[model samples]
Target: MSVRESTFPGVGALRQTGRLFALAASVVRLTFKRPFQKREFVEQFWFIASVTILPTALVSIPFGAVIALQVGSLTKQLGAQSFTGGASVLAVIQQASPLIVALLISGAGGSAICADIGSRTIREEMDAMEVMGVSPVQRLIVPRVLAAMLVAVLLNGLVSVVGVLGGYFFNVIMQGGTPGAYLASFSALAQLPDLYISELKALIFGFIAGVVAAYRGLNPGKGPKGVGDAVNQSVVITFLLLFFVNLVLTAIYLQIVPAKGS
Candidate 1:
């Protein structure tokens, strides 16, 4: 190998990336070839939702309020204060809501998945499953990943509605914005695709989170400490991937979908 390729750091990261992609690919293939695990999927869906719903709702209120306050301030200065609703709504629905779901899912739900799987790995439950001729990826990983995707998509809508209402509440009560103007601005500037992209982002982010967590869980380093470390790594890696993917998706969407007036 060349000097840089021979280096431990570069090789380690590159190998890990390759393995993650491989696991993701296996997941996609297995997802289609399934005697689908409906019960496990339902259990995982509820578990993820229970952990994420309250936090997503709470964080969104402040997130929406902040976006409204910032946009409201800028619009006031530009003498287009009535457009605050449109601007803030676009910001929350198109960007903030999905990001909120991604962050929370990775932080709470993803970590939990990682830790759960990691714990099982260290305990040899995964090995036991393999010995019994059960494919752990199909038995465990696929359902969790699908559940995460579904939950993320549903919660994206929840966050969108809650965020918009929160923004509306703060804008009207604190910023002296009229409800009619706020609602009208949304109608004027926002369109259906904004919501579409937000939900799509959520779906992809969930898939990323679930696959990363399951991958780490499946290949935890060594022992209890290793499992703990893997859990942390999974969360951090998923977060980084989420933002990078979000950037790419946003760029692609912008290119493909013309803005409201343009």
Candidate 2:
């Protein structure tokens, strides 16, 4: 490549990075600035929670049940029935909750935000905010980002609890596992660290969703076609980022934190 051409790519990448950092910093600062806006916060919080709960509950419950069934069958063959709870609980806590809910937000909630903002951008509503001396980052971006993180944490907690309960209920109530034993095994093996890691994943993944959606919407080219394109691109990129970040976070969590009592 010619020097000028190569420099163009580097410059573009640097500009993108700078914009991303600026948005993230703005989001963090704005989240704390008007912290007493309880009414606004509660409205946004409800919107977020409503978006996340159904999917996490629906997906994780059956997922945990099926996971227990599979693990239980295998362990039964090896005369290690009690370990089913351990396997089911660990998998749900470590992988299912944040991963599944992140995907849901990527498609469901994230896409909605993208489309909403993209429409506003197309209509010049964002420009209006700019004209009025409102920082779009503070007014538009911060609440949603904070809400996403809050919703993610809530969804992760709900999923983990519901999934384990569903697994236990399914195994004991329908699949011939003893109820007391299953509960005992689950409680014995599941620790706070497993839950903590999942919460961390949710928080980070939520932030990624917010930033990815906002970045795509806020930087669209122009016009109706641009809005449509931004929405499509936003969904694809948000999904990709969610999965990629999930993998990296999982790796870091595993490396930095030893197993419970290990």
Candidate 3:
């Protein structure tokens, strides 16, 4: 392919990125303007939470169990089996919780948001609202964004707890590790800061997923096919952005929060 052809895609991506950022800023700005949509926010929160809770719990348990199994085996090899709980807890809290929440947000919540908005766009509801002098960003997007952020933080905590418990069960019952040792060592390498960082990561991830979904949905090209494509793009774009954000956040957290006993 010609250099120009390759460059065109990059240029278009950059433009899209800029538009998403601008839309996010607009949502944030409009969120605090008077006459907040309390009903819409509450409804969105319930919708997102109801859809995500079961899936998040199911995913969290397996994730925790897998981590426990792997960490337990490695620790045994290193003669550090007693520290299994500590390692598992740290992994679940610092890494797994935020990542899982992000994936769920994108896979479940993001797609739903995209499809809902896309349908409204295809039906010309958005245009009707605009013609009526209503700001769809403030009325529709802000509530979803705020709800995602709130639910994500709560879901992160739930995932962390479930993951740790799953790890405990796996390590003690499945792997023949001592239950007392596993419980005792859990806090040995964890601290308050880890929980704080995990919540923060979830909040950021939720906001990004919500914003990206909203942007894609709001700007769908033209028809039923456009709605389907927008939903697909929203999930893909949210995942890509979330992974990059997670990497950067993880690095920053590690640099700022010294490990326990370090």
- TM-score for all models, in order of appearance: 0.94, 0.85, 0.94
- Model 3 C-alpha lDDT per residue in residues 50-130, reported as the tens digit of each score: 999999999999999999999999999999999999999999998999989988988888899989988887787877888
Deviation in angstroms for 245 in model 1?
A: 0.6
Candidate 3 global TM-score? 0.94
Q: What TM-score does model 1 achieve against the real structure?
A: 0.94
Candidate 1 lDDT tens digits, 1-262: 1011112133477787877788888889989885888999999999999999999999999999999999998999999998999999999998999999988998888999989988887787877888898888888999999999999999999999999999999999999999999999999999999999999999999999999988888777777777788888888889899889999999999999998987
- Winning model by lDDT: 1
- Which model, 1 or 3, shows the larger lDDT? 1
By summed lDDT, the worst window of 10 consecutive residues in model 1 runs over 1-10
Off by over 4 Å in 3: 1-11
User: lDDT for model 2, on a 0 to 1 scale?
Assistant: 0.76
Judged by TM-score relative to the true structure, which candidate is superior, 2 or 3? Answer: 3
Question: How far out, in Å, is residue 211 in model 1?
Answer: 0.6
- Candidate rank order under lDDT: 1, 3, 2
How do the residues 1-262 of candidate 2 rate in per-residue lDDT, one tens digit apiece? Answer: 0011111123476776677667777777777775344565567678767876787789998988888888888888999887787778888888888887777776777777777777777677777877787777777777777777888888888888898888888777766888777767777877888888899998988888888777777766567677677778877877777778888988998898876646
Q: 1 or 2: which has the higher lDDT?
A: 1
Candidate 1: what lDDT? 0.88
